[model samples]
Target: MTTLNALHQLDLDHHIHPFTNLAGHQSRGPLLIDHGDGPFVVDAQDNRYFECVSGLWSAGLGFSEHRLADVAYAQMKRLPYYHSFTHKAHSPGIELAAKLVELTPETLNHVFYTNSGSEAVDTAVKMVWYVNNALGRRGKKTFLARRLGYHGSTVASGSLTGLARVHDDFDLPAIPVRHLTTPNYGKEARPNETEVEFTTRLGQEMQELISHEGAGTIAAFIGEPVMGAGGVLPPPVGYWTMVQRICKEHDILLVLDEVITGFGRMGRMFGLEYYGITPDILVLSKQLTSSYQSLGAVIVSDELHDVLVRQSAQHGSFGHGFTNTGHPVATAVALETLRIIETEDLVANAEARGAQLRAGLTLLEDHAAVLSSRGAGFLGAVELVPDGPAGAAGLKAFEIAHKHGLILRAVGDALVFCPPLISSEAQIDQMLAALRLVLDDCA
Candidate 1:
């Protein structure tokens, strides 16, 4: 049998990673994850650690979900794979689409599948351009995103992402997209500024940008209800309402990138429902199948779908899709995942556990290294005071947590925690205990 060191050498020799420093990895090697158990993962040497970030914030059902495995197996045996393109379809695709439509806001009635969140973002962007071209509004080509908002890391979607790191060496923002202010009240809100006042300021800035750019030149505005990878920053009170109103006034499409916030992560079926805003386009992934399989969907409104249909009639084909657009196995797993979430009442559990997490973290706000505790549902983050450099403090906290057998993500100076939705109060307390220890060590 091949030894673990030999395997590690093989990985270091041949494997390329994303968003990673290759040189650093070559020297230290990768942290080899062998397997998982519920909300925890085991390293190659059998070191078990709590999975606080839920496997990149996608595993809402956690690890070792037999139902998801069973569903995938059943679908593979029944009808391994099929394409939604060229008029060919499968039951899994049809049923998953219908279920998504039923769960989303009434405005979104059509579903377009992709292989990942990045692809979903590209699909949404393409749809906007396609619909505008079909409607003879070619000038409406630019997009308005927000700084620190993470969409995805594809050509077009990466362009839509407003984070500098994503664009720095990539020559990104490749498309005509402008970034606005993120709706983070903790750091961005002016001193003594009321929530309503902060919202108004943001709204005014958006309207001014639209007027300056000429609304006809803008196609859509994309944002996450809560900025995830950029930092788990929830919107200021009434922020979405004001932004939605502005989009309507200018006829710019509102695209909600719920890749992280969707699938009950925010204690709601969809973040739009929580905020009471109906977007023109919705991008979903991550927990869609609890990351058991790579899948994503772009839900569009009837009005936009009609335009695409008419365009197809005129142009003979829509000319957009992937071979695995609606893979049977992926959709099957997603369906079963949704069933589990609903039947297990994980949404309600997320609400309860999220409250507990926020409260526990709030108690640490007075710690010397802590700055703020912010979250919604099971998604939360702690901004730490910078010690040596920008990411120094957050990195220290992460290392300390890992030493205690807990997993957390350090994004810049923020330590983000997103546990499984099904986590019990006891598990919540255990996580809190780990966090408390990290807090003291960092202090």
Candidate 2:
């Protein structure tokens, strides 16, 4: 067995982790995660931590799932690898696509596979352009996104992401991508502005941008139903509905980035369903495979799909695919993962436990350090105010929570919590209790 120190050295010497401070991590050494059981993961020294972020908000079934292992192993034994190109197909891919079509919004009838969320978003961008081009609207090339909204990290997707940190030094926003204000009532709301008024104003802002840029120049407007990496800001009431209406009025394609909110994370299979809005294009990833495998998909409306098919036929081929676009092993695991979510009634569990979690965390609203507690289903965040000279109170709280046996992530001044969908009532209580203790200690 490799020693902890040896593993740390190896990681420091070679592995470059995403969203990490490389030099700081190299000096402090990485957290050597050894294994996981249920909702808990153990470090190299066997210290268990409640994985509140669910392994970067993807491990929907949590860790230590024997069924996923069995599915992956069986698929490996049968057929380890294959490509989905030139009409080639596999059983798992076909089945998963059918199930996804069934589960997604009624309008999203066709699915295009990708190896990751970034690839899926890139593909969606291409599809939108292709569709517009096919319809003879070549000037409708601009894409509109919301400020602080995150899509993915590939070239086109990264440009679509509105986070400054994601664009710094990258020379991004490369193409015709524009951003509207984030609909964060807590931070963006004006004094005396009600949630409904804020929603109206946000819609007006979108309309203003569209008018200024000329709606005919814009191809699509992309947004997350609930802004995830932008600090878990669920839209105020009537936000999505009005946005959808605006898009329809302007003939703009609406692309919902459901990377974080899809597959029952928001107590619905799709965020669009929860928000009661349908989109021309929908992007899905993260929990689709429950982190059991790396896979993502872009579900298109029938109209868009028809245009894409015609365009591709005219062009000879689509000219977009990854080597592992629909890897059999990943698809097999995803198929089984979806089955587990269905059979275990995990979506219902997420709804129930999410209520418990919200209730428990809301009790901390009076805590001097906590500014707000907001959540939808199992995804939530606690915004904090800076204490003392440093504006690192949220980061400090994150460290304190980790030391107290819960893994939490910080987005600016917010403590983000997205536990596994299978998290039990006791685990929810444990998570809150850990936070309470950490807050008390920090105070």
- Per-model C-alpha lDDT, please? 0.91, 0.88
Please provide, for model 2 over 105-181, each residue's C-alpha lDDT reduced to its tens digit, 9 standing for 90 to 100: 77789988898898999999999998998999999999999889999888899999999878899899887898988
Candidate 1 C-alpha RMSD relative to the actual structure: 1.0
Question: What's the C-alpha lDDT at position 56 in model 2?
Answer: 81
Candidate 1 structure, TM-score to reference: 0.98
What tens digits encode model 1's per-residue C-alpha lDDT throughout 348-388?
88888889988988887888878888888678888898898
Question: How many angstroms is residue 384 displaced in model 1 relative to the true structure, after the best TM-score fit?
Answer: 1.3
Which ten contiguous residues of candidate 1 have the minimum total lDDT?
369-378
Separate clash counts for every candidate: 0, 0
The residue pairs in collision within model 1 are none
lDDT of 2: 0.88
TM-score of each: 0.98, 0.98
